[model samples]
Target: MNRKGAHLEGVFLDFPDLIGAYLNGTHLERTYFRWANLSNVDLANADLADANLEGTDLIGAKNLTIDQLSKVKTLYNAKLDPEREIALREKYPALFEKPDE
Candidate 1:
């Protein structure tokens, strides 16, 4: 299996924290979740293209695919692609861009 990540293209997503913040689907593409803790979070209908959530806790979050990992981040502020970010906003209307909500 090629990991089913052809649609996911990028290198900015390499860590877990950066991926968890934007669980609402606003940043980080193709993020691999190799043992991250995301317990009790609302992740319904989030877009997780190529994220690898091998061992993570997503009990409350709904609409989250088993193969999807929450990924998002910014050096100084919220940084996301124009298209992807916009899509995220449209996808997840319940949860805001930030995860700490």
Candidate 2:
């Protein structure tokens, strides 16, 4: 679905399969996206500050730069593209910590 400029701040959206969705210019600040499938989704210009992305799959996502993800509050177990993951790893090492045996 294409929802450009949508205001979804502080909303709870779990386990949604939103592949290829157009979410540009959306206000997703502090939103909860746990276990959501957002692969290939577009997040250009989206405000995601303080958003919870725990276990969200964002592999192959579009228009999501390091600058944008840098503003996110939580990325625990979230799956991002390799490049973005590398950038985030430096800033949030806990995101990449190995699980205890």
lDDT of 2 by residue, 1-70 (tens): 9889999999999898899999999999989898899999999999999788888999999999887887
* Residue 12 lDDT, candidate 1, scale 0-100: 33
- Model 2 residue 10 lDDT score: 96
lDDT of 1: 0.39
Worst 10 residues of 1 by lDDT: 69-78
Error of 2 at 71 (Å): 1.1
Q: Indicate the TM-score of model 1.
A: 0.38
Off by over 4 Å in 1: 1-22, 62-101
Cα-based RMSD of candidate 1:
13.4
Which candidate wins on lDDT?
Answer: 2
Top TM-score hit: 2
